[model samples]
Target: MNLKATIFGLLVFFISGQFALAQSTEIEKEITELSKKKWQWMADKNADSLAVLFHDKAKFVHMGGTWGKDREVDIIRSGGIHYKNADVHEVMVEVLNENTVILWNRITLLAVVGSNEVTNPFMVTEVYVKEDGNWKLADLTFSKLMTRD
Candidate 1:
């Protein structure tokens, strides 16, 4: 009886672990696709799409300053900083849990700020959370890369 019980417990555990792994993979793929869409939206200055993706309390950290969702949206809408393009060099997504994920990417951005075009390499970190069965951007931070691309 004892041997049978142990075997049953081990089987349950193995099945649970496999299910979790599969779920994580699905989440990673979802977030990766979202991240790519987000970059394209930024380049296109689609504030409406971004407004939907970003949480109300989302925070954005940039080389110049940090701000909340409203401010970031306003900046994009007003063309304060225009994202012309983002040349992504590499990207990675990590599932922190069932409802949270983090994405890291190395990218070179071509942007226009105050009539000046600038291209800079950066390592961007983005955090996302699932809310109401949808993934929303929670936080974004950009670290300027010293190495030129």
Candidate 2:
């Protein structure tokens, strides 16, 4: 009876570990897709779609300053800073848990600001939370890369 119980416990542990691994993989895939869509929306100046994706308390940090959701949305809407394109070099997503995910990406961004066009490499960090069965962007930070691309 002791042997049978120990074997059963080991089997359960192995199965649970596999389940967790599979869950994380799925979540990573979902977050990656969302991140791509976000870049597309920015390039297209689709503030309406972005508004839906960004959480009410979402924060955006840039080299110049940091702001909350409303300001970010307004900036995108008005084209104060246009995201013309993003040449993504690499992206990695980590599932913190069932409800949270973080993504980091390195990209060269083509942007226009105040009539000046610029291309810069940046490391972008994004945090997403699952709320009401949908993923919402909670935080976004951009760190300028010192290395010239």
Candidate 3:
């Protein structure tokens, strides 16, 4: 499909509530729940919980910069960028392989950065890998959106 058509399709998918009501597979439900909890963890600044969820070499990408797991944990712990809230409007889960999955969340985030409180729409991509029977976040990247509700 062309880029415009793809975007439109996604836009329609998000706007419709049918997907939310549809029954998900067992693994899909698991990952969706985990993703929801991740947002709560960030809002609560529970770095300890996040530390356990993030992979040892996980990478975090933000508007300002990109960093690894340690820095992300420290940033949350120190309130460098307080993730006050993430209003998740829609989400898509795509299982890549036996051990990998990709989750896309359309969210409007309320955060505090250097004493400045800001809210922005973002397309957040989270990649998860199953290791030792647990899912670890391998990557988290936030892409600011030009469109806003």
TM-score of each: 0.95, 0.97, 0.83
List model 1 lDDT by residue over 1-149, tens digit each: 69999999999999999999999999999999999999999999999999999999999999899999999999999999898998999999999898999999899999998799999999999999999999999999999999978
The digit string of per-residue lDDT tens for model 3 on 20-122 reads 4442355677888999999999999999999999999999999999999999999999999899999999999987765788999999999999899999999
Better model by TM-score: candidate 1 vs candidate 3: 1
Model 3 deviation from native, Cα RMSD in Å: 10.8
Instruction: Please list the C-alpha lDDT of all candidates, in the order they appear.
Output: 0.95, 0.95, 0.92
Weakest lDDT window of 10 consecutive positions for candidate 1: 109-118
Q: 89, model 3: CA deviation in Å?
A: 0.7
lDDT comparing candidate 3 with the true structure: 0.92
Candidate closer to the true structure by TM-score (higher is better), 2 or 3: 2
Candidates' RMSD to native: 1.1, 0.9, 10.8
**Candidate 2 runs further than 4 Å off:** none
Task: Write the residue-wise lDDT of candidate 2 on 1-149 in tens digits.
Answer: 69999999999999999999999999999899999999999999999999999999999999889999999999999998899998999999989899999999999999987688999999999999999999999999999999956
